[model samples]
Target: MADATHSTGMIRVWDPLVRIGHWVLVVAFATAYLTEGEPEWLHVWAGYAIAATVALRLLWGVIGPQRARFSDFVTGPGRAVAYLRDLIAGRAERHVGHSPAGGAMTVALLVTLGVTAFAGMGTLAAEEGEGPLAGIVAQIPETDGPRAYTGDHDEDEHGEHGEESAWKEVHEVAANLTLILILLHLGGVALASARHGENLARSMVTGDKRA
Candidate 1:
C-alpha cells in the first residue's frame, strides 16, 4: 500500500505492525534481560515473546509495506561500510526509510536476539527438563551407575549436565552480544538523528519522516 502523506509533510513509513512489534520487542528483551531468569515464568515468557516477534518481523520484512521490506534497504556489507564512511564524514544521503547501516544493524539485532532466545530455551530444556526442546534435550540416557540410582550426583550421572552448561554458555554469550548490539544501535540512531536533523526514534513511533 502507498504511504499516506499529509500537508504537514509527514508520511507513514513504518506500518502499525512494524511499530508495535518494535516496541514489543524492546519491552520483551528488556524484561528478559533484566530479570536474569528470576521469576522463571516471566523470563521464559518474555523470551518466547522476543522469539515470536522476531519471527513475525522476518516474515514482514519479506511481504510488508514498501519501507518495511528488506529489499528496500538491505544493501550488502560494502554499501553499509560505504554509508558508515559517508556518515562519519557528515555527507551521508538522507533516506526516508532505513539506510544501509541501519539495515545491517536491524538484521544483526534480529539474528542475535533470535539466538539468545533459542539458546535460552535450549538451556532450560537441558537443565530443567522444561521448555519446547525438553523432549529432545532431556532424552539423554542416564549412566548405569550407583550415583545415577542413588541421585547422589545426578548432575554428573550423564552428559546432560555438560550439555546444559554448553547451552547456558551459548545463551549468556548471545545475550551479551545482543546487549552490545543494542548499545551500538542506539548510538547509531542518535548519531543519524543528529546528522540528519530528525528524531529517528520518534519516527519509529509516529511512522513518519521528512517526505
Candidate 2:
C-alpha cells in the first residue's frame, strides 16, 4: 500500500527553502534557549542566527513557491478555531500543506520568536553595553562615591541599572513565552499526525507525505 501510494505522482508541497528554514530555526532556537545567559557569546550569536533565519523566512513567505507562500496557508482566526474544533472531534480534513490551525501556529511561532530574539538584543545592549542597540541604551554612569548614598548621584546610578534590569526581564519573558509556544506546536503536530494517519514530523524531514 505504501509503495502504491508512492507510485502515483505526489506533489512537492514544502519547498527546499521552507524545509531548510524550518530546521535551521529549530536548531538556532534550541541553541539560544538552552544556553540562556551563561556563555554569553554562544547565546548572543545563536540569537543572531535565529534573527537572520527568521528574516529570510519572512522574505520567502512573500516570494516562495505556491505552497510556501503565506497566502497559500494563512487563514482567518475563525477558520483556525473551526479547524481546531473539528480536530478535537476527530473529523478534521487532511491538508496537503498547513491546515488552518497549523497555519495559525506557524504565524504565531514566527512572530513570537522574532520578538524574543529582538528583545534579547535589547537586553544585551542595555545590560552588557553591547549588541545592536548599544549606542542608544547609553552606558550606565560610573560611581566613585563611598558606601554611603549621595543625593541624585545614587538615583542616577540606580536608575540606569534599573533600566537594564527592565530590558532583561522583558527578554526573559519573551523567551519563556516562545518556549510555551513551542510546546503547544509539538502537541498540535502530534495530534494532527494521529488524526490524519500520517507521520507529519517525518514528512517535514523528507518533504513528502502519503499524497
Candidate 3:
C-alpha cells in the first residue's frame, strides 16, 4: 500500500457542524458589539445567539470528528513549550487540524466567552430589576467587584453592576479581547494556508477539500 498525497493542502479540517458553530459565534459577537446601544434589540438577539452557539460548540467539542474534538489538539504546558520551540526553528510539523497553541487559544477563548455571555445576561436581568438571581445577588459584597453570582443586582453588592455603565464597560472589555483572539486566529489560518497551500477558510465553508 502507498500513502496518499493531497493535490494541495486541501485535506478536510473542520466538519460542517464545526464550521456552522464558528460562523454563528462570529456573527453573533459582531452583531452584539455593533448594536449595543442605538439598536439594542438586535444587540440582545446577538448575545442570545452567541450563547446558543457556545452551547452547540460545547456539544461538538465532545463528540465531533477527530480534528474537531478537543482531544485532538489540546496539549499541556510541556507540549506547548515544545510546539513553540519548533515554530521558532521554522521546523514545526504542519498539523491537518489546529496546532497545539491554537488549541489552547481556542479553549481559552471559549471559556472566556462563555463566562462573558452568562455574566452579561445576569447584568441585563439586573438592569431590568428582574435578574434570574436578582433576589439572591442583593446579598453580595459591594466593596470589591462583581461577585461570582450573587445576583443582588445592587450596585454595592460586592459584584453587582448597580448601573448600566459598569455593565457596558465589562461587556466592551470582553468584546475587545474576543476581537483580538479572532484576529489572531485568522492570522494563524492565513499563515497555515500559505505554508501548506491550503484554503483553510474555504474548507470551513463547503466542508470539503481535496481530502
Candidate 4:
C-alpha cells in the first residue's frame, strides 16, 4: 500500500496502521488521563496501551507508506514557525500529507506522550515495585504496619524518595503538557480545515484527501 493512490480524485495519505494508531493513542490517553490513576488496573493498562501505540507509530514513521514517513513531513522548527505564521495570515498552502506545523505537532505529541507514559511506569515501579522498571528504580520498602515517622533516613533512602517524587512530577508535568499540545493541535486542524474548505478530521477517518 506504499504507492496506493486512487483515481477518483482522492489520495490515500494515511495508511491503516497510522489511522489506527492515531485513534488508539487518543482513546488510551483519554482513559489514562480521565481516570487520574484511580482504579489502578485500568490506568496502568491504558498507559501501557499508549506506550505501545507510540512505539509502533514511531516504527511505522520509519518504514510505512511515503506519506507516513517522517521524511515526508517532518521539518525544522523555523519552517514550522513560518507555516504557523502563514496559517494565521490565511495564506497557508494545503498539504496532501501534513503541513510543517502539523508535522511539528505530531513529533511533539509523540515525544510528550512517551515521556508521560514512561514516567508513570517509573512512578509505579518506585511506589509499588511493579512495572518494567521494577528493581531498576529503587522500590520503596514495604511495611506491615503503619510506621512511625522518625526524622531518620539513610542517604540512600532519601535518594530513593527523591527519585520517586521526581518521577511523579515528570509524569504530571508531561501529561499536562500533552493536554496543552492536544488543544493546540485541534485548534490548528480546525483553522486549517476552515482555511482550506475541507474537513481535515474527516480525511483522517477516511485516510484520503482531494488529489
Tens-digit lDDT track for model 3 on 51-147?
8788788888888777778888888978766765676566777676777877877887787677667766656554543334455445455423344
lDDT of 1 by residue, 77-132 (tens): 99999988999899999888999999999999999999999998877776666778
Local error of candidate 2 at 198, Å? 0.7
Global local distance difference test of model 2: 0.78
lDDT of each: 0.86, 0.78, 0.69, 0.85
Please give, for residues 62-97, the per-residue lDDT of candidate 2 as tens digits: 988767789988999999999999998999988988
Question: Residue 90 of model 2: what lDDT?
Answer: 99
TM-score of each: 0.88, 0.83, 0.74, 0.86
Q: List the residue pairs that clash in candidate 4.
A: none
Number of the top-ranking candidate, with lDDT as the measure:
1
lDDT of 1: 0.86
lDDT (0-100) at residue 210 of candidate 1? 81
Which model is ahead, 1 or 4, in terms of lDDT? Answer: 1
* Regions of candidate 3 where Cα sits further than 4 Å from its true position: 1-11, 130-169, 209-211
How many clashes (backbone N, Cα, C below 3 Å) per candidate?
Answer: 0, 0, 14, 0
RMSD per model, one decimal: 4.4, 6.4, 6.2, 5.4
Question: Which tens-of-lDDT digit does each residue in 104-149 have in candidate 4?
Answer: 9999999999999999888777666678877667534442222222
